[model samples]
Target: MALPESARLEGPILQELLALGGEERLRVLYRRLLAYFPHLDESERDCASARWRTLVQRAGARLVKKGELRREAGRWALTERGRQRAEAEKMLVEPPPEESPRRALSHEELQAMLVEIGRLLGKHAEREHERYDVVWKDSPLSPRLSHVFEVQVHGKLESALAKLKHAYDTQRSKPVLVVSDARDERRAREWLRPYFSGSFHEIG
Candidate 1:
């Protein structure tokens, strides 16, 4: 079967979820799948779309046929063989950093810079907080957090964006992702394509 971009991504996504979570309901698994591949467009992102849903179902069906996965009653899971395959699959890991002539900021230093920027703006600034790497509040006395910052160094880009999205949804604070290099910035921008509504911002 011809696999489109969504189908291509769904195969590995389903395998990863099944290996990690065991049996998963299709709806919930699909939600996580969308999160993992944020470059998907509108029609592909719509869970209610039959065509999109079929792509996921087809991926599962192929895996089941390969004796790597099983599906029953709207739930999908990996077989023992599938678990091995998933474990064997090479992860999408970040490549080793190239040597730079200029000194680079450490992750903590990046967070500190964000906090310092907030302080200079006269906002209450803090770092290493739960939910965000750095946060800026309206004032020293006010409890309102006005901005949330996440610094991505060599960690999973999706995990960082997930936290930023959560912060935006819960507090309506402006979410910013700070990357260590231009390569990471490009990756972050590609992921934010799904957020055409402009829910996230990237800072170098």
Candidate 2:
């Protein structure tokens, strides 16, 4: 008996989806499959593209045949068997492990690692300063800080303003000033006023 369209494509599609951990939406799966094997004919990509709805139906049919996927509340999730297959395939391709270290880091060694990390970060920030309009440290209630860079172009200021507002809403701490510059300092100040609460300044 001749197989249906979805069933015909099932083996290759299932292999690809399993390789990708089998948790992707149909569209994402489709794109990744094409990216990995670009020679797959257009007809193959179109096999399930009658409509967006049809894509899921085709994927469902394919998964049903393998007995390794299930639909739960409009989302496809991998079964345990599916996860095992993915893991097996991954193990086959993974490189051999390197030799383990003789001993764990001592306190002095850990402190040296921290100092190296800070030096690398300072160099990275210096490079970013050369290429961007503004760079600032984003700190919250925690001691850790995240760096944010802003380039003024094509509504970028507006984008930065929105991001700053989001950060303020989510985090309870204030950001540090490492370096900053502005094309229109007044405009930058105006945009950041609501979010910064009068803590904006130049970094030396």
Candidate 3:
């Protein structure tokens, strides 16, 4: 995606926050960057566009300290003052920059895509950070064949799961488990370990 010479991802961050219309945790925001988040740092440092999207996210995050935003519970929101300025400058309502195919999906959209792959007619799999890079096939030959995940790294499970359920309302597989971090991953693993000794597929 083409980031502005100055605001880079920070500009879009501001608009996304406005579109959100309420307080949002940084981790939640980070997850919204998903699949694109982890690679931000290792990208070209000289080029803001080159940096991993997560690095851009961090730059966007710095807006908080800059007094352009507000925070609570480690979450962030558009400050009334910032919102007012954005309204006048028209920064909060700009369209997103063009992006590569993968970059197009928001964090939630990415997760939805992952879960959709689970239901593919034949064997299929996809993976990323919060998970791993691996290849697997959907098969009854495998003992573990249940469970679905939308690899968003943030947001409360209640709303996340609700949105996910709304997307695909079939109980054909295990419920879509929404996790915030590794702790949740461990908890889920421990909880599911006893029942399914088979593979634990991840899509993050």
Worst 10 residues of 2 by lDDT: 172-181
Question: Model 3: how far is 39 from its true place, Å?
Answer: 13
C-alpha RMSD (angstroms) for model 1: 17.6
Which of the numbered candidates is closest to the native, going by highest TM-score?
1
Where is model 3 more than 4 Å wrong at Cα?
A: 1-6, 33-57, 89-204
Residue 132 alpha-carbon offset, candidate 2, angstroms? 52
**How well does candidate 1 score on lDDT at residue 25?**
81
Best by lDDT: 1
Candidate 1, residue 168: CA error in Å?
Answer: 0.9
Q: For candidate 1, lDDT tens digit of each residue in 1-204?
A: 222554465456545565557677888766656555555576667666777677777777777888987888987787888777776663642223445687778998998888888888888999977768998989877666688888988788778877877877777778787878755656756765765445444321
Candidate 2 error regions (>4 Å): 1-22, 42-48, 51-59, 89-204
User: Residue 126 in model 2: shift from native, Å?
Assistant: 54
Residue 38 displacement (Å), model 2: 2.3
- Each model's lDDT: 0.71, 0.46, 0.51
Query: What lDDT score goes with residue 3 in model 3?
Result: 26
State candidate 3's TM-score.
0.32
Off by over 4 Å in 1: 1-100, 183-188, 191-204
Per-residue CA lDDT of candidate 2, range 1-204, in tens? Answer: 222355434344556567666766665555544433334456654534554336446756777667777766555567787666556665443323445756644434443443455455652222233233233332224332344333333454445454444444454223222113334657656656664553332211
Tell me how many clashing residue pairs each candidate has. 0, 1, 5
